[model samples]
Target: MTTRTPLTRARLATVGAELADEVGFEHVTASEVARRCGVRVASLYSHVRDADDLRALVCLLALDELADRASAAVAGRAGAEALAALAGAYRDYARAHPGRYAAMRHRLDPATAAASAGPRHADLTRAALRGYGLDADGETHAVRLFGGLVHGFVTLELAGAFDHSDPSPEVSWEWSLTALDATLTGWSTR
Candidate 1:
């Protein structure tokens, strides 16, 4: 017989996410998570199958939150405006929750991946591309391009890769978005 802890699964996951931010997702452990939550390791086992399951939950939470933000950011907008909004939202989320963002990139199981908010994210990106008058292949290309640019910028920014620049990160981000907008608009299907 397993004894459940007073803390709920949601609360445990939240604590786990915070610990991940402090100690990194790769290093997170059920023992550490238990300590952070003021509970025994055995108690946590009732709520989560294992460290991997907890990590998967964190990834799902992050993806859902990101998808919500992206949806709100791009609502009723189209073309460059939509693109900029989506990019900015993504950057903002990544900056605000680096650990959660890292968790979202983990290689989840196929069933978990299929049930994730990733598809909603893709749909949002696709909707934004509709303003560009792109074909199916072009839309796919645009999504990849946008993902690359956003992820690259955020990764570099988090690693302090642009700390020595004269222009602020914000300035660079805006300029990058502008360039992206132009590139998408002029993309040739050659």
Candidate 2:
């Protein structure tokens, strides 16, 4: 006879996040999560509709954490300073939490995305670009450009793709930021 520990959506989400960190987000399962919590698979069904729901919750959690980090990094900063800070904050967070970082990219349903921290992320990006005086299209372009740069660079960095290089990634990262700043400066008021 086993005692069933009480579970909540929050606890289930936390456990799912931890499992993701251990076994890759794509491989995390409700059954495994239940195992970790010493509960039956059916027990998790009550807490989460299914595995997808668990992943969605983890994704939202990761996005929220990232928004918080970006908010702190960009606070009281503007223009290139804010851009660099935001980029660095994202890079640092991704490196620190690879699993959670991966989860942040997971696609959420429209309604789920509306309620997720993803909007805050977009707003922060727009805020950082405000000092450049870009038109709506320009801001959109810059957002996509910068977002792609950060995500691609971090993904490559984490995959050990830079391990063969002689230039330390630290140096490369700074160089990339410098280039990004220069590009933004050139694009401003254009």
Candidate 3:
């Protein structure tokens, strides 16, 4: 038997995310992750419990990456500008890191989801809406709306949903941002 090189959990998790970016997130496996890490499959068991564990770690990593980007994007901005910035951050991240982006769509365990970057994401959204003075219900509505809008557009954009159209995706992206901004500004009215 070939000797296996040891790898840290953090290192394994990082490589797993990279693998998810290369292949589909659902395709991520301990064998594949180990292969990418230049190690035997058994080596991975020392780091991750199994493929699911690795995927969960990857999901957490992706969420952290997204939260970091969103936080940076909204720094010092207010109201619609911050909303646009946050939305831009999500769009840019998804387009650039499709696999890692897909990892986030993977359902994480409840405790894992709560302990991961998800809360930070929600906090960031609420903080961005702070200047708008929305009521608690309105804030929750805005959060869902923003999440669905950005995610829906990105899903369509990735699946070539806009390829057959005459309007360029870039134009549509800008238009969407403009519309989202308008909606956020007038959200309390509806």
Candidate 4:
């Protein structure tokens, strides 16, 4: 039997995230991850509980990354500008890391979800909405609306749904942001 070297949980998570980007998040396996790390499968058990745990860890990593990007993008901006910045940041991150982006949307155990960077994401969204004068309900609505648009556009773009379009994905992305800004600005209380 080959000797296995110990890997830290952080190292394993980084490798797992990279592997997810390589072969798709769903295809990531502990054995394969261990192989990539030059360690035996058994060695990974000491760092990660199993495939589920690794996936959750990956989700956490993705969430934190996305939150950081969004926060940075929206800093020193407000209103539609801030919204556009945040939306663009999210789309840019997702496009750059499709597999990791998918991992961010993966459902996690309740405890994991509660403890993950999800709250940070929510706070970022809420902060972005401050410029729009959105209250609690309006902020929630804006969040869902923006989330749907980003998710829908990215999903379609990734699946080649816009490949044959004339305007190009980038152009459409800009137009979408413009339209989103208009919608948020004109939101009605009725």
Which one wins on lDDT? 2
**Model 2 alpha-carbon drift over 4 Å, by segment:** 1-5, 188-190
Clashing pairs in 1: none
Off by over 4 Å in 1: 1-5
Q: What is the TM-score of each candidate against the true structure?
A: 0.91, 0.94, 0.91, 0.92
Residue 50 displacement in candidate 1 (angstroms): 1.9
Which candidate has the top score in TM-score? Answer: 2
Summarize candidate 4's per-residue lDDT along 1-190 as a digit string, tens digits: 9775458887887888998888899988998888999988998898888898888888889999999899999999988888888888888887888888889888998888988899888889888888777778888988888889989999899879999969989999999989988888888744
Give the alpha-carbon lDDT of every model: 0.87, 0.89, 0.87, 0.87
Clashes of each: 0, 0, 0, 0
Q: Which stretches of candidate 4 lie over 4 Å from their true place?
A: 1-6
> What are the per-residue Cα lDDT tens digits for candidate 1 across 75-101?
999988999999989989888888888
Better of 3 and 4 by TM-score: 4
Task: Indicate the residue-level lDDT of 166 in model 2.
Answer: 74
lDDT at residue 58 of model 1 (Cα atoms): 79
In model 2, which range of ten residues has the least summed lDDT? 181-190
RMSD of each: 3.0, 2.0, 2.5, 2.4
> Between candidates 2 and 3, which one is better according to TM-score?
2
Report the lDDT tens digits of candidate 2 across residue range 16-87.
888887778887788898899988999888878888898988898889889999999999999889999999
Flag regions of model 3 displaced more than 4 Å: 1-6
Cα error, residue 81 of model 3, in Å, equals 0.9
